[model samples]
Target: MRKTKKKNKIYFPDPKFNDSLVTRFVNHLMKNGKKNIAYKIFYNAMKKIDLIKEKEDKTALEIWKEGLKNVMPHVEVRSRRMGGSNIQVPIPISSNSKITKAMKLLISCAFIRNEKTMSNKLAFEIWDAFKEQGEAVKRKENIHKMAEANKAFSHFRF
Candidate 1:
């Protein structure tokens, strides 16, 4: 019962890519308020992608975008009370939330990758995602499967 909705904060585009999305991704990647370190890691990962990319037609940033898109989930499941019973309801996600979730998943999967450095791990994760074969992609697929399984309960969406 709030009187007003919270406003979204504005983020300036990153220095290297001039993309607000990149800024948002770095914000998600950031730890302990060390934005400079996060930016360094992200930029380094982009450089690694540039060195190892297979598709010459697309840039590193483009590959990252595609990978993120691949990880974005269209629907998600939530618990809802219906007829004195809890039901898993499938709900459509908004575009902004989809992007946020995708970024978080990508970063988290990158952290779990077996690599020498954060940059290397992130670069490999991005490449794997771009190829549609990575933990992030798998997580997205799992979410889709859950949503599909609970399609009958979609009527309970709030």
Candidate 2:
């Protein structure tokens, strides 16, 4: 690699939750340089989740974390070129990468939800993920299944 690896920047936790993960989520959710708007949308979604899942004893943040975990992929397949052929090689994912992938899948799936508002869509997706039955969760499951199916090509992993 030509460039040195960039040092990871430290992110201070958000005001309400005092959690760095929440800040990271909000950062991913941010668009057009509007972080406050992203925070508002996330906080509103959390409030909606609280109201919708009232029977659950856990806080909204806990639910959100659980949802993220549910969508985290343990293994993924990558394209590898070997012996004049391309192969799908299964590989284990690092913990940090799993979290990043889960967050990205959740955000992308939530964006496609058919809801009146972004907050409502995100809240609904989060609730579904917490139940282990959402598009994002399914996507993760599919990724793992594909990796398992391609286990014979694991030797091709670069």
Candidate 3:
């Protein structure tokens, strides 16, 4: 057991977007340490989003950020073992972990999409999230519902 919390490493922002959030997402999307490929996929998806929403006044980066914001969950459930039984406890999520969860959901949903390319799938997923109607958003809703349903158990939260 450690006495102190671990320190998070500072990440450099992406070159094109200059946002550390994008860097974090690309890092999560990276497979087998192929960070360049991950960055390419993300940038390509952003470009595709721009082309698709040419009529909209919003930029692709703005859309992506909004989408991620929409998918961030405020609460989640955790199982805790009590005296003689285990119970699910509803707990509020930390700001940092909320972003991590949203990014994971987006990437997982994108991977399962029936698109020819990773960029295409990611573009569609992000757009759906922006519109508040995607797997990531749906998952967030489900999590909220579960948290609400288990609100009585919140006292067990650590």
Segments in model 3 whose C-alpha atoms lie over 4 Å from true places: none
Cα lDDT tens digits, model 3, 1-158, are 65787688699999998999999999999999999999999999999999888577999999999999999999999999999998889998888899999999999999999999999999999999999997889989999999999888988878
TM-score, model 2 to reference: 0.94
The digit string of per-residue lDDT tens for model 1 on 6-84 reads 6887989999999999999999999999999999999999999999987568999999999999999999999988789
The predicted structure with the larger lDDT, 1 or 3, is: 1
Pull out the clashing pairs in model 3.
none
Q: Rank candidates by TM-score, best first.
A: 3, 1, 2
Model 2 C-alpha lDDT per residue in residues 62-143, reported as the tens digit of each score: 9999999999999989998888998899999988788889999999999999999999999999999999998998899899
Model 3 CA RMSD to the hidden true structure, in angstroms: 1.4
Q: Provide the clashing-pair count of each candidate structure.
A: 0, 0, 0
- On the 0 to 100 scale, the lDDT of residue 87 in model 3 is 88
Candidate 1 residue runs with Cα over 4 Å from true position: 1-3
